[model samples]
Target: MARVLFVVFGGLAYLIFFATFLYLIAFVGDLPGVPRTVDHGPAGDRITAFIVDLGLIGLFGLQHTIMARQGFKRGWTAIVPKPVERSVYVLFASIALLILFAFWRPIPQPVWAVENPLAVSVIWGLFALGWLIVLSSTFLINHFELFGLKQVYQNLRGAAPSPPRFRQPFFYRLVRHPLYAGFIIAFWATPEMTLGHLLFSVGMTIYILIAIPYEERDLVGALGDDYASYRGRVGMLFPRLRRASPSTPPLEARDS
Candidate 1:
């Protein structure tokens, strides 16, 4: 019963997010106080924007699907994590508030308009260009997950000690945390970037900070001294061109 409830609620929540995303695509430029003269373009540009939004939805769906495959229980358990139960409520509340604002907020039509068609085109073009880069990065990162290719080491949950297997090449060659990097890029390039979205960004950043440390702690436990050496070489979220050591094995030879 709990699993069933979770699936219903989670699906509804996903729909609400997609609905708001589409709403933003249609109305962002029309919002009151929004500068009209920023940029405008051909119908093709509008279609491109729709494609980007759909791609984002797909990317998020993929992430959730992967987690579900990893033994995610159904219903409320699907929506709510048993660990940190309070966080589930907060997450749902936040999503609900964002949805309400997306639909109910009275965004007045901008009095100051983009009178020039050329200028409007330019604004849209710039947004589209940035979005393209963001989407490309996200798609590349997700491809790795879809393939189920493991790298040198994996981070165990809850700061437990574990060593991820060593990897020599491929996508893992460039960055330690490609998924997080993709997320950061997407958030920055989102067309609906607003004060509320900035707040969401901060919230996500905090979660990353808190969650990563514990996850690292677990890796340390599993990998022991070897993970410590890798930690010294690889960065948390950034790709470094040069590091002191390239491929150091975790102290513990066995995979956790």
Candidate 2:
């Protein structure tokens, strides 16, 4: 019964996180339906809005970075069941994102607005491609595990989760972090760039840059030589001029 209840909790958490992720796409893209986007939102004092936006980004960075640390997980799991630890992390991260989305204030003053029809179309194409890469990269590893569903399912089945292994499938072969690369592309490729949008992109880019070292440190500690060797050969977020053999392993990224 406890195991079953955990599965229920995990399922709910997964649903919430998935919904938040989808909404995030819309929010970042400034799509039509979302109530508040990076560029479209309630007006406020520019200075105040800037501070608030900065704080929101900081909050997310803290939550994302701190919770993902191995030290945090080592202590955190003493209270949270091992099976649901990842799920709880996902839940908390989703909540942080939701809070950011809810309180975001847009400074819609134009930074750059592309007038050329062809350029605009190209930028939009890159935006879509970025999102596609992000989503597909999740599957290249284990999406269920990355999102926490697989751990809970294993718990329900009274089975142990698989150990981490090294990998660089397809997009990963080109870049060590295709997911982050995708986000960078999506954020910067917009045809209409506003102060708010620029801030969002810049903030996220800084966070990604800062986060990568710590994440890589963790990966190296956990994966040792295999990952180190892989890192040596591949670009952190871009394709190397040289190539590696087509063999990839299953090294989990936790969720970069």
- Index of the highest-TM-score prediction: 2
Cα lDDT for residue 41, candidate 1: 22
Q: Which candidate leads the pack in lDDT?
A: 2
Worst 10 residues of 1 by lDDT: 147-156
Clashing pairs in 2: 165-251, 166-249, 167-249
Query: Residues 117-212, candidate 1, lDDT per residue (tens digit)?
Result: 777666566545544543454445443222221111111122322224443233334555545554454443433444334433444455455556
Where does model 1 exceed 4 Å of error? 1-169, 190-193, 245-256
RMSD of each: 12.2, 3.7
List TM-scores for all candidates, in order. 0.38, 0.94
lDDT of 1 at 14: 44
**Cα displacement (Å) at residue 88, model 1:** 11
**Shift of residue 42 alpha carbon in model 1, Å:** 28
Lowest summed lDDT over 10 consecutive residues: which window, candidate 2? 247-256
